[model samples]
Target: MTSIEETAPGRDHFTDFDLDSPEFTEDYEQVLGDLVAKCPVAHSKVAGGYYVVSRYDDVRQCAQDWETFSSEGGFEPGRGGEGGAKLYPVELDPPYQTRWRNALGPYFSPRAIRSREANIREQVNYLIDGFIEKGRVDFVEEFAAHLPGRVFFGSFLGVPFSELPPIQKATDDAMRGPMEGRGEAWVAVATFLDGYLRARQEEPPRDDFIDVILAGVEDHDGNPCSWDHKLYVLTDLLAGGIGTTTYLLAGIAHHLATHPEDRAALAEDRSLWSGAIEEFIRYYASIVALGRTATRPTEVAGQSIAEGDFLMLSFAAACRDPKYFENPHEIDIRRKIAVNPAFSFGPHRCIGSHIARLEATISLEEILRRLPDLALAEGGEPVYSNSTIARNMDSLVVTFTPGEREGRTE
Candidate 1:
């Protein structure tokens, strides 16, 4: 295995563009477009020793071929070691990874998620009720950010609303990348889940997700998945599901507020919900990139990459690549859409994709119904997250007409 230092001589890739820069976040589409056009497989010295794959075909292939590009180590540079362990099945390769994934798959299936719809809708309405009367609210914190964490935890673990705050805090910290005191936060969350899992194991089964995972039997590397493994998997699910969905929700709200015509068109026909969500995902590409390590020395698109070299597959760039979709830069809800790498492609595709769609679709439909004339607050600018793994807005303020019914009493 090539060390991080020896992988590239003399420089790091991705120095010119600051992944966290406000300018990049503001003009992300334009910047990525230029890069794809100029150098689809560009190498940057600033990003340590990694190469960026921006074209649609390249990214799709990188995601599909687990043999050539392994996900075992952390996808991004410097994250593969200890930091990557928290990702669970996502950070593991096939065969071994498949066991854990298959074990948890039934819990997030379409039918299972549908069973929770009434509860989800009630929760959404509750959150919206708290803010709808105000006419103006920060959609991220007051609404979007709160919904997913609560719903996922409530439905999966059968936890009470009181536990959401600390869970949300830990998940948010994890999404922001490694931080001081995060170890303690992870421990606290893990400890709580361990107790919960042990309790569930002893009791008669409930229909919730925790019951499903615990009741099912699976072996990882000759050993049964202990409570620790279950806790880690839950942590990964909470972090991955909540943060990305929140970002996409904020993105949709931001776009709709600015482009009333699109919102109006959708309002006229609620059947367009599915397509509208797809268009939103393609337009925003919230989770910017997926990380991979070259399992063996591989040559892609005429560029030679050595074994163990870090690679960043730019999903944001690929989704908008004109090679795949015409007028890729423009957002058109009417466009005939197909499978997008937005939820990723191949084996490691998002397990919670169905749930995410249900959440986003329900949230959008309800928001439009309650406040049809929503618009961004005057001079409001979105605050975005900085991590390379996930792209998200921190906050979005909006103004809309009040609903007849109040949402949450608190």
Candidate 2:
């Protein structure tokens, strides 16, 4: 695998695109736009090679037709087994995947997520209180990055908040660390999850999500899932809940800080925040691309994909397809999005999307209310890191008028 710093450039994107390349990280929107128009299904030789599906329609078709483009092989290109433990459901095909979704979906439904909004809002305000008085802060590190884990642990997963730091660090390293170190990072994450799950099993059942996971579901053949498989599911939830939401939050914060006019509009009209949140999710999709393997021979946008070939379905690119979204580059809060691919599509569509939206909406509302004068500080440009699975913002600094804390919570 090529490192981002060592990634060579000047290759034809249509024939040899690399998602991990610095080119993709720097010119993400442009590279995908060209591909969507010129070569909807472009090939890449990175990580033993794979094809990229850039257009909205093609990416959706591939994601929806999981049988033709199987995920059981894992979602990373080239590294395949080397990418660390397989995340359940996202890496599973139907029947078994469906079973898991059926068993767990209710916990993440809009209604269920809404019930936790108070908890989410409390955490959002609490985090802001920590930095509201500082007058300056790294938005990503100080706020966007921490809220999701706090909510996930406190409201959904029932884990101790103290356990979040190490798990969060290990998760970050596994996803964005050096190539050789990622696997070890994943092992550390897995070890933590393993113990957490076992400890939950030993305690009296709380009838919560964790206990539901411990109950275990049937495999395709009706066999009970392994303890390790349960850990995979839990790990996937933690990563999806925390890591992806962090990017969305950071992106929204950066946009608000840079475009005060837009922020003002949203601040004046709280109802617009919902649409703006959706627009932000579409514009700054957290997972840039995810891999799907050809279960057999298939064709996408006139490109012939051989059996067992890996394809990177660029959801970030799909969201920007001109055919699907008019004025694809601009953020239109009122633009009616018939279908947003930001959370992906088909059977494997993200189950935590409601959580993400609610979290974003609350965070945006609080930030604008508390940090209304928020603006980018001098030399404060967002730092980003790209990978086959996701794109993340590492830092975003902002300055705001100092505000008083609302007093500590019990």
Candidate 3:
């Protein structure tokens, strides 16, 4: 599809940029390309009134300036927290954000990550075993979703496997599901977490995240973290940890199936996997956009904004900015990226970044070694949802060289 600039004649400001429309989202590179070139800072009327900052410097500025752009506001304009639940650490700034980060950060500390590595490696191989001999499988359903579902739900979060389906469905819907159904989707997520968190609060077994937080994690005031805040943070982990990684792994599979040369190069040299994963993240940034409500009147990228306005920091777009990257569109695994804002920027950056990279890197190394010739499955169409929030593939059907699994024994 031609860019809005070329076809729209004298139309300077773009209103055709709808994140929820696949027509716009499926072709995100081209869409963001146009925005970066023609409109660094543009307004969208989609979710009421908001500005999208598409440039690298501008987005970094907005993300770094927590006082000006507050994550505390619910995604949309005019919306705030639910009851007393702030959006956990991401939604908070300064002393509160610091308190929560310090308290829960230990859960994913280096020692914790090293402990999980063995299981993560085992799980990757186990999931591959299910489809390695079959020669074809929906990578998303059988592998991408299952790997994280097991890792995040069963291992990390300690959520009952029985409850995963509804929780996963609710989060997926709330982030990228239909517009009319969004309220229900969000409500479903909160309801499940509310019950689960409330139960954990009473029990205080300290076995998992909820137990730890409920048992003793304190707020800025050194008081026990509020129940509502705990729920929000738990939701953040469930939603963020599961959703982002699922799509990214599927995206790596999609890229490998389509690009034979890069796949061959990586398979030929195991060392390339580390650097390649970084490039892959830069290419397919999963968290499409994060919201911030302007606390005071401010200008981004030389564009003026009012105090009450909301802003969208497009990390996906920022990663694609040519000013920061040499060949912004092309995927060059060998390229040494000075920096990529895929995990976001500043204090609000994702906390689970180390574990996420470990998951992707290990999964890729094993999958490539075991299923060397996997190709996009014939007669099946893959799906990527077009949404304002998350960018994830729904399905990735793939066929591989058969009997590769039989050659190796666990």
Candidate 4:
């Protein structure tokens, strides 16, 4: 699809770009390519207007200089903290944000995440078993959407598996459901988190990730964190944990279904999986952009940014910058990458990145070994939904040769 710039002469991308608009979302690769090549720093009038930074060097510099471009302003462009709860650490600047990251960092370290590999594999197989006998399934609904929540509840947060449905539904609705009903959906999510945290406080320590939140960190003013502040931290973890990885999972499944050669290559060689996952992250990045506020006057890619002005660093766009990548659009699993901005950069880089990679690695390994003949359903096509902050494949139907369930070996 041609960019909106070509299709509609009046809507110049430099001044009238809307990340969430159908024009941009439907043909984002071409549109983002245009932005990177022509206007590295483009302005969007949508959501009260903000500047977008699209080049690889520009995004890295802005992300590294937190003092100049503060995150305390929030990540979403027009709507900051859409659900009414502030996501801490992410929405905070350094020193203060530093304290929180320092406290929570150990839990997401490679060794810590590595320990959960067994349970993660079990969860992956458990979901696959549900549809293995049927010869067909909606990968998003039946598989991708459920794995994160299961791992979150069963491993990270230590919630009961039975509680997954209501919380997961509330999160999905709050994130991508109808605009009118989002407020109520967010309320459900917040209410659940509040109750869960309060209950955890009264119980004996479990020495788990939630325990770290309950222990609390010093606030920006050097005082002990407030009760509500603690709630904000918990909210961030839950929201991040439950939803973000689904996009990567669904995208990979869809890619495998559509490209037989890529699937055949991956199925034949297991060693290719690591580089493949990183390439998938770079090529099919799910995070579109994240917002940062300029603290004072600064210049990025020759574009002047004033104090209090909003700037969106496009991680997806950075990954596609042609200067750094040869064929930025095509999926090359063996491609070498020095720096991948898929998880953003600097201190606010996704703490869950290790877990996300592990999940994708195990997921691809099992799906290929078990369902060798996976292909798109006869007439099924992927439907997508986009927001200012993230984009996801909503549904992907696939047909595979029916196989027997490898029931739990416990």
Candidate 5:
């Protein structure tokens, strides 16, 4: 088996393209269409020696067949190489990965999530009311971004809402890649969570997720999870639950604001919210791609890939693949969906996906019901975060018609 490090002497097809370019985000459809048509499995010299899989089936297969394409290295190539330590279940391959999954699964179950819906809704409406009086506000900061962070911090840990902003900012900075002065941001989150966990450790278990995980026994690992493991898991939960949900909500808002017809259709009939949300996931696909390393030499789509090769599975490209979706570029709420790997596939699929959907659905429904006349700020596009793992707009300024604020119940 040829090692991935052994560079093959071949013309790299995607050398002309730059993934970090803003044009790539703005004109992703055209770019993805071109990639799918010309080279579905193209070699990239710029991506530090990794083959890019742009087609839907190829990417799906990479995610499904965990044995062939292992995540032991980590998800993102850059991050995977950095820490030297793999973070819990996301970095572990099955049957070992199964243990981590099972341990965290019960807490995020549909029934467990439903139990927190009342509290989640309460926080959502509270944030909505805080900015509703302005009539025009940055939806991302004021609403979309704020909801998940507060809910995760406050509801999940029973923390005060006042403490959420600093934590949210720290997590956001950490995920958006290493920035100047951002090194301490992650440490800040760790420090805060450590203190919070220690304080809660002596108390009786409650309905919150922290309590569940702290008290719950490990099903596979045999020994109880150490406080360090619990902290890592909680950090993962906070980052995944808040960051991705914020991006999805922002994406939904962007799509609705830009596409008037779709917005009108959704506004008129709230029943279409489910389909619209699905379409949003397909269209924006909060994550652009997920990374994996080849456990051994493998052949995929007639291309010979070497062992220890880093693979970039293009989630954005896959969702827009014409082979699977008709009019792949079009955002159609009415499209009948079979299955899309937007939430991913197989054992490593998103654990918090159900909760993400619920949060997005509830947020969208409430926004539409209360502010039907919502419109993007004149002559402005939302500011998006430059991130590999999560696709998100930073700030979305929206103007809404004047109206009486609705009262929220817990």
Candidate 6:
């Protein structure tokens, strides 16, 4: 995409629009609305040749045709053309993908997630209690950034607390795209996983996710998936499970802070939270966009797409399509329950969607219960990390009247 410091000629063309442009973070709805209205299948020059599908129907069509729009065309920052760290099932297709899904999806299934609620509640409450008395807190670092990973990665996946920090850093750094020493950082992570597996190999089988995975989660061939494959699975699980929730929670918190009317309604009517959470997820989709490569000559939204060409599905944009959503810009908690693209679509729809919903629901209920008076913490401002793939707030400072905890037992 083209950019100019001053208003230069030909800036009105869709080619001048860029997902990575800083303006997108500020007003994507406005920008993407224009794209959908004018160029639903607009071409972008950034990150090699790509066509961005902005309309809901078009994006949905691409997602449905995974055969034509393969997810195997990776999105890693470096490693030659491939996206960083293989994402297992998300990076696989069909029967093989089904194997990866079976091995992992059950863990986050709604029934399985119920087993985690007590701990999730305890963990979330404990984190809030840490700063509840202080009346102010950095929600991102102190909570959002730490909680989901701690639950899914640290607690569920059985990574020792002592070893989580470095690996978490490595995964994050590597995802922020190609940078100096990303390979080294990735290697460090792989080395840690290797050692972790080796240590597990010596011990008796345990019930932990790691132990079960190590004991032998079979591939499509009915043989155990290789350690390398396992490493990517672990990496994908950790990476996918953490920041997505972090950003979503952060976005919700931001919404509550900025839109106090909606916040008040949610607070007053607890039953509204479940649907409201979904609405919030739609309104402020943090996993903004994902890519698929055309496997062969394909057509979408009347635009001819060549094989091997990249097509970016703008989920945030799709969620706001006026065709599907009335008063699209306005946040309505009671919007009729139809398909939402916040978790994506088709076979690759978010595996942890149920877990994420439960977590967000519980979190919403608890935070509102405890901090009924919570608001923007003094003069604090929210910060965000904007990228084409995802744009999440970096931090959100919020305040509430110092309150007592429920002191529930574990």
**Best prediction by TM-score:** 4
TM-score of candidate 2 relative to the true fold: 0.93
The prediction achieving the highest lDDT against the true structure is 4
Ranking 1 against 5 by lDDT, winner = 1
Clashes of 1: 11
After superposing candidate 1 on the true structure, give the runs of residues whose Cα lies further than 4 Å from its correct spot.
1-18, 21-23, 82-84, 173-184, 215-220, 407-410
- lDDT of candidate 5 at residue 130, scale 0 to 100: 76
Ranking by TM-score: 4, 2, 1, 5, 3, 6
Return model 3's CA RMSD, one decimal: 3.6
lDDT of 1 by residue, 198-313 (tens): 88888987766676467534544666666555666766777678778888888888888889999998889987878889888888787777788998988877789899887788
Instruction: Give the RMSD in angstroms, all C-alphas superposed, for model 2.
Output: 3.7
TM-score each candidate. 0.89, 0.93, 0.87, 0.94, 0.88, 0.87
Give the clash count for each candidate: 11, 0, 0, 0, 0, 4
Q: Write the per-residue lDDT of candidate 2 for residues 1-410, one digit (tens) a residue.
A: 22223333455677778888887788777677777777788888878888889889888999999989988877787545545567887888898999889888888899888999887887888788888889999998888888887787767766555666777677767766678998899889788778888888789987667877898899868999987778888888987777689999999999999998999899889878778888999998888888899989878988888998999898999999989799899988777777789888999999999999999998888888899989999999999988667889989999999999984543
Whole-model lDDT for model 3 versus the true structure? 0.76
Model 3 lDDT per residue over 301-370, tens place: 7888888788878888888888988788998889777667888888788888777788898888887888
Query: lDDT by residue for model 6 over 138-251, one digit each (tens)?
Result: 888777776776676565757765666677677666544355866787677667767777787898877655665675566667777777777777666666766788888877
User: 119-230 in candidate 4: lDDT tens per residue?
Assistant: 8998899889889999999998899988887787667766665667788788778876788999999999889889988898899997777888888888889899988878
TM-score of 4: 0.94
Each prediction's Cα lDDT score?
Answer: 0.76, 0.84, 0.76, 0.84, 0.74, 0.73
Candidate 2 at residue 345, lDDT?
A: 95
Task: Give the C-alpha miss distance for residue 91 in model 3, angstroms.
Answer: 1.9
Residue-by-residue lDDT tens digits, candidate 5, 196-273: 888888887675667755764553467775666677667777777776788788888777777788878888887888
- Once superposed on the true structure, which residue ranges of model 2 sit more than 4 Å away at CA? 1-9, 79-84, 176-181
Model 3: weakest 10-residue lDDT segment is 7-16
lDDT of 6: 0.73
lDDT computed for candidate 2: 0.84
Clashing pairs in 4: none
